[model samples]
Target: MTIVVAVDESSHASRVVEEANALANAFDDSLHVVYVLSRSDFVDMEETNVSETGDAMDLDRVREIAASVAEDAITDANATAESVGLVGDASSEVTRYADDIGARYIVVGGRKRSPVGKAVFGSVTQSILLNSRQPVVAIRKD
Candidate 1:
């Protein structure tokens, strides 16, 4: 059976990878990593989107940063198993990938967030929990 992990190169993500690897080792299953680059991360040089809340980040730059983040997560995951696969998008992307690979479960890392941040950002964990058809295991960073 294949286990899919949603990684973002964060402490939480690392923890998830560790847990996933442990489970994989015990069950003799393969581990797959999915790193999501949000649509807001795709930006063109000529276009500029300014938010009323004054939070503006370059989509193109975010993609580059996300790629770096994915690389780091992949490296960390490799320490456990050399055979690792990467997919983009922690939300829908992860779900699609899991379906594509016929994964039995999805392991996701959830970080502690403030009430305000949670309200505004809408945690990916929550989204996956609500959306995924397969079982989703959310690993928290302690």
Candidate 2:
């Protein structure tokens, strides 16, 4: 069995990684860590600024941060598997990765109750659950 985790730099992501690792260890399964970098995030900010010249896109910096996040998660999990940075919507990319990896389980961290529209709705989780054939475990922060 392969367990896939959608992790970010959020504190909640640590708990989700730990939970996923525990489950994978119990099942003797390999663990896969996936970090989705929204395409919007990868855009060249300087270009939009329109006041900067001779400045290259800071792809190296972005890659460094993404690698750091993935490394931390994988290290904390203490299991060997693949780590990938994908460019797309979080849910869509994660679901596709899950399918590609033949993941038996997927784990995602979501915000706890929040003010206004910041809260993660049950429907959103339900949609992922519906879209994924594999079981999805949604972890909420305290």
Candidate 3:
């Protein structure tokens, strides 16, 4: 089976990838680490600060982190992993990819709970959990 892990350019991304890597190794599954370029996040920022925005558009840093983690965490030599770059809503893109690949699990990093309810997750995490047909595994950020 496949394990899909979605990440952003945050410290938590490395941790999330590592966790997913371990899961993949355990099950002898392939891993696909994804970094979604949130249109909502950068479009406005792109307008306000075009210079800074150009650099952020490069997702190599995020991809490299996941690649390194996957390399370090591999227990099964045959297990494979690759990084994917996407553009769209994080939740939708991730869940869609998981469904498309028939992933065993969609792994993510929990940002926090919504202000509305303690049990309610932040928008992205909540959306993935609610919409994904595959099971989800969210690593809580420290």
Candidate 4:
């Protein structure tokens, strides 16, 4: 089974990749990295495009941009893992992918958020931690 790392554009993504890489090496497992572009990202992108270009982006352009961003994040992770850039809900997609692949472990990055902040913002990390059936390793931002 693979060691799956759920990646994003967050600053702690590299740390998560490093930790997942180490785990994969230690466990003699393949490393699988994935970046999910949620619907919210599409909405944000459309808003930005409208504001900047005076028009909203088409679906194809939005998907292209999302894939590009995912590729950039995967490259920045700096690991030689097999990577996938997908479009879906972040936490659910990551967890579902890991389950579907029968991952040995799932790695994710965590930001230090106050209880109130977490309650209001609703963290993806927290969602994954709570929902995933597989072993999850959370790497906190330094």
Candidate 5:
């Protein structure tokens, strides 16, 4: 079994990685870091015109951008006994991957949000917590 950590661009991601590493060490399990690039991310990039050449970015370009960001997160995760994976559908994909890999725990970062704020902006962490059959650990930003 493995310990799965969901990685994102959030500041709290490093903390979540650290926590996952520690858990993996304690449990003698491998660590897997997963980053999910949602369709909304692609839409946002297109809408915001992230490319300097004003060219329409294809899925490969978007995947490259997402992979670069995920690599940064993995570097922050300390790069010890960790393999990184990427997919689409942020919340569901992470959970599905963990299930497929037979993960012992799913680690994620938690942002401090008021009840109204959580209601207004649904959280991926909340979705993982509710949907994952594996045990979950939520690390907050320091």
Candidate 6:
């Protein structure tokens, strides 16, 4: 069995991974950490994208950043975890990744938001909770 943990460079990734690691240890499962670049990230990247050489950052660089985010997020975790990076919607991508891996559980760091806030801005965590086939384990940020 596998435990899938959705993470980003921001958010309480360490907390989420810590919880997921505990569950993995209990279940004797491997862990997979995933970082998804949402549409917003892409747009932001587009707006302020520059490399050290002064060239615009390419998609490959964005993907590399994604991989690094996933890998870095799991550094504090007790167990060694596989990291994957993908580009797309965070909610769908995380769920799809979990389903593809046949994960026993999906762990995510859920940011608390007001009902009005969620309705207006939409919540990736909320979407994952509702749509994922795997059992969801939500770790709220402190």
Computed on alpha carbons, the lDDT of every model, listed in order, comes to: 0.70, 0.73, 0.73, 0.82, 0.80, 0.86
Question: Which of 2 and 3 is ahead in TM-score?
Answer: 2
Instruction: Give candidate 2 misplaced runs (Cα > 4 Å).
Output: 45-65, 76-81, 114-127
Where in model 4 is the C-alpha error above 4 Å?
Answer: 43-70
Clashing residue pairs, candidate 4?
Answer: none
| Clash number for each model | 3, 0, 0, 0, 0, 0
Instruction: Please list the residue runs of candidate 6 whose C-alpha ends up more than 4 Å from where it truly belongs after superposition.
Output: 43-61
lDDT (Cα, tens digit) per residue for candidate 4, span 58-131: 87666566556545655676767876666778899889989999998999988899999999999988999999
| lDDT for each residue of candidate 6 in 48-90, tens digit (9 for 90 to 100) | 7553355676787787878888888888665588888888999
Candidate 5 or 2, higher TM-score: 5
* CA RMSD of each candidate after superposition: 6.5, 3.9, 5.6, 3.1, 2.9, 2.5
Q: Which number leads on lDDT?
A: 6
Ranking the candidates on TM-score from highest down gives 6, 5, 4, 2, 1, 3
How much does candidate 2 score in TM-score? 0.74
Please give the range of 10 consecutive residues that has the lowest summed lDDT in model 4: 65-74
- How would you encode candidate 2's per-residue C-alpha lDDT over 34-101 as one tens digit per residue? 88776777664536544465666576555555656777877776656567676667778789888987
Identify the candidate with maximal TM-score.
6
TM, every model: 0.70, 0.74, 0.70, 0.80, 0.80, 0.85
lDDT for model 2 comes to 0.73
- Candidate 3 TM-score to native: 0.70
Evaluated at residue 71, the lDDT of candidate 5 is 68
